[model samples]
Target: MAIYFYGCVTMDGYLADSQHRIDWLHQVGSVEDTGYDDFYKKMNVTIMGKRTFEEIQNLPDVEKFYQATENYVFTHEKELKVKNYQAVEENVLDFISKIDKDKNVFVIGGNSLIAPLLDADLFDHLIIQIAPVILGKGIPLFTQSEFQRFYHLDQVRQFGQFAELVFSRKAPLDLPIS
Candidate 1:
């Protein structure tokens, strides 16, 4: 499957603050400023870590926040009775590997969940909008990992005070849009 990550991070590379809050991102740019609507149009399913799901649930009118075709949450819990989300306790890599190769999976963040997938080289694309402000310390976009990976810059768009950077994995993933 074509796996992609979509998030807004600070210039310093943090996804959220120490409080698990992204108010800094909102302070600098609105949802449209991040081009989330356009990005979501290319995704069939969204995969997020449990903590990230919880954070979304805490938001006002959570149901509308992630209106994707399907939602999957990676959690340690074996059972989840949530109405709209499927809980996966299985290996994230294994789970993703089994999905249809043609499908586009959007990996939502919280850093910890992104590290393993990133380190394993499972992501096909990454679209991050850099907020104007920087929080010297907070939850980072990339977690601690030993391996190194790189992506080619496909496009960069500037919107007022924000900038959207889109990168695609090299070689096989650099094909032109169909």
Candidate 2:
């Protein structure tokens, strides 16, 4: 099973503005029109940051996900509660690794959730939507520094002016040890 992340970013690479505003995103393209629907459908489990969970609560269909047995929000705020979301403060990877191997997991982010996973090299794939506009300052898609990594372009698709970039992590090739 593949554990991946999917979100729309600006041309300059931002998921939201300084104030955590994604209004600019809706100005250019909508979630339904974009490839998000298809990407979300394939995901059986969800792992997201607390800020992201807070942001998503405003969505009309947030209640729909309460049915999932595996919906987690990584946060230190033990008091933070969002209906059915399980608050996880332990090691993110340890929590993630325990999920059913048969299910495909989606790491939904406001950038905070995926940073450590990216650092630990736990993610297998990353699918990003590049919106047409740019936010000079905002939350970045990847928040890690000094962590070297590589990926192979798996696919690319266009939705209106937005571009969907799919990348699969390039596992290091095994070599002779002798």
Candidate 3:
């Protein structure tokens, strides 16, 4: 499966403010103005943390927002309010490994969720849209990890006030046999 991460971060590389609010993202531009719609169309499934799910549950017609994809929310809660989303309590890596290989999985948010996957080098593509604003202190997109993973810049595009950077995991080098 191709695991993808698509989200907006501040120039300083923060996903949200200190309060874990994405209000800054709305102030800069709307989702319609960005390439989100096009990117969302290709995904077959979505995975997100409880906080990320809660953040979006307040939206209008939230039930239908991700109707197209099989949504999985990693939470300790016994049940989820949304019938469409399945509540998962297992390890993110283990849970993701069970998904069909042909599916396109989109990771919504939560640095906690992304960090482990990134560290394990399971993320296939990262599409980060860099917003112009910079919040000095906030929840950063990347946290300290032991190992480093490399990616190649696939493409760059401007979406109004946001600059989208598309990166794909670098392929392993084929060494010559002596």
| Winning model by lDDT | 3
lDDT of 1 by residue, 102-150 (tens): 8899998867668888878888899887888879998888885886576
Candidate closest to the true structure, highest TM-score: 3
Q: Estimate each model's TM-score.
A: 0.87, 0.86, 0.95
RMSD of each: 4.1, 3.2, 2.6
Once fitted onto the true fold, the runs of candidate 2 whose alpha carbons sit more than 4 angstroms away are 65-69, 79-81, 174-178
Instruction: Order candidates by TM-score, high to low.
Output: 3, 1, 2
lDDT of 2 by residue, 1-178 (tens): 6789888889999988988877898799677677776677778888888777878778887777645546888888775545778788988878877888888888888576678888888788899989888789999888975766878889999988789999998868732234
Name every residue pair that clashes in candidate 1.
none
Clashing pairs in 3: none
Q: Residue 98's C-alpha lDDT in candidate 1? A: 81
Residue-wise C-alpha lDDT for candidate 3, range 64-97, written one tens digit per residue: 8888899999999978987689999999999998
Single out the weakest 10-residue window by summed lDDT for candidate 3. Answer: 169-178
lDDT of 2 at 145: 59
Question: The CA-based lDDT of model 2 is what?
Answer: 0.80
Between candidates 1 and 3, name the one with more favorable lDDT. 3
Give me the runs in candidate 3 sitting further than 4 Å from their true place: 174-178
Q: lDDT for every model?
A: 0.81, 0.80, 0.92
Give the CA lDDT, 0 to 100, for residue 11 in model 2: 93
Q: Which ten residues in a row have the lowest lDDT in candidate 1?
A: 169-178
